[model samples]
Target: MAVERFPVEASHIMMFARSVGDPNPIYHDEDYAKGAEPGGIIAPPTFVQASSQYDPDAALRPKPGQPWFGSGREPSGTPRGGGGGGGGTGLHAEQHFEYHRHLHPGDVLSAKTRPGKSWEREGRRAGKLKFSETITEYFDQNGELVITARSVGVQTERVVEQA
Candidate 1:
């Protein structure tokens, strides 16, 4: 619903690596990473995409009284609608990423994210559903661009009918 920006630090990358159970020395060992094929310990591509400091609140979440379509519950008692209203179901439709350069420790990164596209569709069982796509850009401390990511989300108002 709102566009937000934030800075990324090396710790974020390290934490993400640890959380994902990636023991690649490149992610943790500076010397090992420096010796990697690219000449510098580069963060995993997936790590870069997953590494960010954006707040969940900045992104759209389901509101109260809404069906549990997998997005999240609203603090209030009203079913929150996403970008569009086909009922309140949500799903991760797609993700696309592009990397300009690799992220390293001590690199200060910044990101700006916003809802890019949205639409509704009819499901075999869920009836009608709404979905939104979000795009985020990551930039290095020097103002150089590093990576760009696009994530798709599907949402619906009612539970999908069982077959």
Candidate 2:
């Protein structure tokens, strides 16, 4: 999936930094950043994760009554995990990012997301666990690669009946 171009603004960077509990002057204070090595306000490392919000059809977004991948199925006539059968909710197993260059204000970035890998393994307690990975590469308006991020999701199959 292709995320719509996201315009990096100083305010967005500041807000994102604040949300992540980062008080770095380089991310929130343009004046301070200008005197730093990057020479302008730069976004934090995990800021690329917010690109999902710019995607209209982002799979991770909530959709009432729809079971998202790794989110277990709800048995018929049973409230979600109320009884009958149940499974573990989606779990983010891992995340990684490789920054090739600094992301600064005024840079319009776009992301290309694709499935990276999938596999399954036997689990002593869960019966079986499936793992899926996704990768998103962010590019600048000039078509320069800036960052690459990988995320893994895990779902475990039920090995015992719901109590």
Find the candidate with the highest lDDT and give its number.
Answer: 2
Error of 2 at 45 (Å): 0.7
Candidate 2 residue-wise lDDT, 22-139, digit = tens: 9999998878888999998899999888887788777767667776544355433333452324555556779999999989989999998899999988867666678899999999
Q: Model 2, clash count? A: 0
Error of 2 at 153 (Å): 1.2
Give the alpha carbon lDDT tens digit for every residue of 1-163 in model 1.
2223444455676777888899778776767766777665566777655443355442344545544434335454444454445444566778888988877766766677777988888877766767789987888878887888888877755666766
Query: Whose TM-score is greatest here?
Result: 2
Tell me the TM-score of each prediction against the true structure.
0.66, 0.77
Model 1's alpha-carbon lDDT is 0.66
Residue 130's lDDT within candidate 1 is 71
RMSD of each: 5.5, 5.6
